[model samples]
Target: MTGPDSHRLVRSPGVGSVVIGPAADGSRRPDLVVAADDAIDWTVFDGLTVPAGYPWPRIIVYEGDDTGFFDWARRRPIGTFEWRPSSAHVVDATGANINRLWIGLRTAPLHLTVPSMPHGVLTVNGDLSLLTAVLADGGACPAVDFQPDTLPAADAVPLRLPDLPAFAGAQHVTVTVRPLRQAFDCASLLQFPDTRHLSLGGQLVNVAALAQLRHLRGLQLRFCPDLTGLPALDSWPELTHLIAFNVEEATGKRLRGELRRPGREWERSGVSQLRRPEWFATEYGLPFSGWPAAKAKKATTAYRTAQRAIATATGPDGVEAAIRAFVAVVNAMPGIETTEREDAGDAVAQLAEDTPFGDLTEDAQDWFDDARDF
Candidate 1:
C-alpha cells in the first residue's frame, strides 16, 4: 500500500512495470502492476498486451480517471471488467466481448476520444451524443457530459436522437439523457433486429412508442417526460421487468394499460429543477393593454425579481425573504384583481416548489396567505 500521491503511472505498450512477487504455485512470479495518479488518454491501452506464460496486467488506479475505458474493453476478445475503482483489476490483454456493454467512467482531468466498437448491449452513464453519430465514425461519445440545464430553451427545438446501425443488432441497449431534453424516434427502434432488453432514460419519448420491438423482455424508462407519438404497446410474449420513473400519473396509467400491468408499476419525483431563474419566468395573461398592461408588467417584474432572488438565495432565510418580497409586491399592485393575484401566486409557488423551500418549511401556503393581502 502506498500514499495516494506517491503512486507512479503506467502508460505503455508492454508491461510498464513488473514486481517479482509470490506465485500461487509457491514460486516467485513477476506481477505486472500498472498504476497511475494522473489522467491518461483512452488510447493508452491501444497497443498494450501481455506476454505469453505471464498473467494479464493488473491495473491499480490510485488517482487516474478512465473515460470510455469500459466499453472499449467490452467490444470483442472478451475480458471481464469489474467496473469498481481504486482497486487492482486484472485486465485481459484482448479485452471483453459480452452481451451487455456498460459505458461509464470516473472523472477525467483530460478526456480522450472514445474508440467506436462494431456493436452489442449498450448502457450509457455520461454523454451519449455518440448514439447520434454514425457507427463507423471511429470515435463516438460526447466529449463532455453537457451540463444538465434547468432553464427551458423555450424557442429552441430539442435535438432528436437519430437511429443508427450501432443499435440494430444490440440485444440490450440502454441510453438515458434526461436533463438535456433530447428526443428519439421510437418507430425506428423497431428496425433493431434482435433487441430484447431496452432502457431509455433522461430523454423525451412518446409514451405509446416502443411497441413494435417484439423480442423485448425488459424495459426500464427513466425521466422521460414527453408523451407525443402514436400510442401502441406491442405485446411481446417474453415481456417481463417493465418499469419507469418520473412519469405523470395519467401517463403511468396509460403505460400500465399498454404494458398490460395490474397495479401501478411506475413512480414519479414530480420535480423539474432548473438552474436558471429565467426558466421560471413567463409572461402572465393574454396580450396586456392599457391599465392591465402596466399592472402585468409590475407583477411579472416582481415575479422575475423574486425568481432571481430565490435562485441566488443562500439559505432558508434568504428564500423566505425572496418569497416575502414577492408577496409584498403582489399585495401592493395597484387595484390587483383576483385573476392577477392567483396567477402571480401560482408562479411564485411554482418557483418555490422547484427549490427545496417546501422541504425547508412547514405549511408554505399558510405562510403565503398570511403575507399576501389579495
Candidate 2:
C-alpha cells in the first residue's frame, strides 16, 4: 500500500504522452499518474482484448483496501494561464493514467509556490530568485523596518508586482512597498476590488490611481498629507470605512462642518473613544452635536445665532450632503460610539419623505442602513 504523500509526473515542455496504471489483480498501481492533452491514451487489462481506439483507454484503478478520495487540478497554459482555484476544480480527471495535478503558476523566469485547490491562501513574498524586474536593468530590495523595499526606483518610475492569478478569493492584501512615489498595479491581488480592503499608508505618493479599484470597501491612508482631494468616492457604494489623516483640506469650511462635528459630540458627552490627544487641536475642541437636545437651550441659541451668520455663506444642499456622508462614513467605522444613530436615521427618513431629492434621498437612506449594520 502506498503511504500518505502527494506525487507529480511531468515530462519536458513539448512532450506529447505519459502513462501509469496497474496489471491484472490491481496491486499498488503507481498510486498516481499525470498526462498531457496532445498525448495518446492506451491501456491493457486481464481478459480484455486489445480494443482499437477505446474512448478513454487510460485507466486509474483504486483497489478496495483503502477508502480515500482522489483530487486532480490541472493547468494548461497556451499563451493564456489561469491559476484560479475555481477553474482548477473542473479539470478532466477521468483516467488513472492521467493523475492529479495542481493549479499553479507557470510563467517565464519567475516561479510560483501556489496552494492546493478547494481552499488555500496565495502568498508572494519578496524573494530575489522568484521575482525579477522586466523593464529595469536590475532591481534592489532595501531594508526598511516598517515598509517593503523601494521598488525599482521610487520617483515617477513604473514598477510591477508579479501577478498571482489564484488570488481571486483574497479578502485582504498587505503590501510592504512604502514611500510608493509611483503607480503600482494591485489588479491581480484584488480582482473583486469593491469587496476587499486596500490599505496604502506611509507612502510618499501624491495621487494614487484608486478609482480603477471599483469594489474597494476599506481604505486607510495615514500620513499622506501630500494628497489634495480624494478621488471621486461616490462611485464606491460598497465602501464602508475610510481612515484619512493629515490630508490637505481645499474645502476647509466644508470639512469644518463635516468631519469635525461627530467627534465634537463625543468630546462634549465626555466619551473617551472620540478624544484622541494626537488629533487634538486646541481651536477645534468646541462642542458640536447632530441631535436637537445634546446641547442646553442657551448653547443651542448661541449655535443657531452663529449658524445663521454662516448659513448664507455655506450653501444648504452642499452642507447637508457633507454632513450626511461624514456621518455615514464615521458610523461605518467599528467601535464608534453609536449614540446619535436613531436621530440620524430619523433625519434621513424625513429627508426621504419631504426633500426634493428623489433618488438621492433613497441612496442616502440605503447608505445609513448599511452603515448602521456595523
The candidate maximizing TM-score is: 1
CA lDDT scores, all candidates in order: 0.46, 0.35
CA lDDT, candidate 1, residue 86:
32
lDDT of 1 by residue, 98-179 (tens): 3233333333221222234335333333333333323334333211112222223323454444445444556666554433
For residues 164-265, could you state the per-residue lDDT of candidate 2 as single tens digits?
A: 333434455545343323434443334434336665543343233556667766655543323434464444555656655543344222333443444222
Q: Please report the TM-score between candidate 2 and the true structure.
A: 0.30
**Can you give the TM-score per candidate against the true fold?**
0.40, 0.30
The superposed Cα distance between candidate 2 and the true structure at residue 328, in angstroms, equals 53
Off by over 4 Å in 1: 1-94, 97-155, 206-209, 228-230, 234-238, 257-374
Worst 10 residues of 2 by lDDT: 136-145
Total backbone collisions for each predicted model: 9, 9
